[model samples]
Target: MLKNLEPYLEKTIFNSRWILAPFYLGLILGIVLLFIKFIQKTIMMFNTVFSASVSDVIVNILVLVDLSLVASLLLIIIFSGYEIFVSKIDTGDHVDRPSWMGKVDFSGLKLKVIGAIVAISAIDLLKSFMDIPNELSNGEADKLMWKVIIHMTFVVSGLLFAIMDKVVGDTKKH
Candidate 1:
């Protein structure tokens, strides 16, 4: 009886591809988020152009860069996660995947994501500083300080990740 049941169990386990269906669904959701970000930035850019304030223009530019970075991150996670854990992207012959996509291993992707996060954090911190008045309340200054500290932490962590990845690569090469 156990032997007879073995094939059925195997089939059930093998047909578990449906479990990964949600990940693909999530990727589609991410694409939608990307589109929304793009549209939001476009509107912001138009608004900035109409406004007379130079600082507002600079802020808008920073926001645009931040959005682009976020979109790149979404693409990395969607493509790499899908390829590594789910299934390959169905790019036809006419469409080519990005060259960096081929080169980024899991460690590389992690480092890149961390680096991007650090950059985004730095931009946000700068934006906060730019908005600060000549005399900030104690609470506001404290909050800004915490943000700067968090941004610095992300910067340090990303640098460490890159260093560790390099060290491991060198060790393997030797």
Candidate 2:
């Protein structure tokens, strides 16, 4: 009877593998978009400096940082998602998987992504404050203060995750 049930269980597991196909396809699509964003940001950066507007130059620098953050996120998803849902990445004899592809666990990647996002948001808020008219009576200072608080929260969370990871690693060694 156990032998008879074996084939049915194997077949179910095999069929379930196809469910991940669509998700992998979406990841491929995301990679393409990230590449496009990289190119666009490069062009904008060059153009901004040529136009000689100090504000535009600063904005373009922020955009470059934003693009880099997005690229990091794309890599985390593509590598880890494949490893988790598809197969172990064949790193071969490579000491480190392409320098950037270091052994980042899921929690570590999440913390990094959250931290990057928070930094980007803070930069955007700063840009907005710079754009505000000097004569306006609106409380721009208060808004900037709130953004700083939110950014600090993200920083603290990321630090906590890093410390937790270190503790877990040490426990495993012992």
Q: Which candidate comes out best when scored by TM-score?
A: 1
lDDT of 1 by residue, 30-52 (tens): 77887798788778678668754
User: Can you give the TM-score per candidate against the true fold?
Assistant: 0.78, 0.67
Off by over 4 Å in 2: 1-18, 41-52, 91-102, 118-143, 172-174
Provide backbone clash counts, one per model.
0, 0
Scored against the true structure, residue 85 in model 2 reaches a CA lDDT of 58
Q: Estimate candidate 1's RMSD in Å.
A: 3.4
Candidate 1 clashes between residue pairs 3 or more apart in a chain or in different chains: none
Q: lDDT score of model 1? A: 0.79
The superposed Cα distance between candidate 1 and the true structure at residue 123, in angstroms, equals: 1.3
- lDDT tens string, model 2, 73-144? 666777766665556778787876665454666766676677767777777776766666666555766776
- The deviation in Å at residue 72 for candidate 1 is 1.2
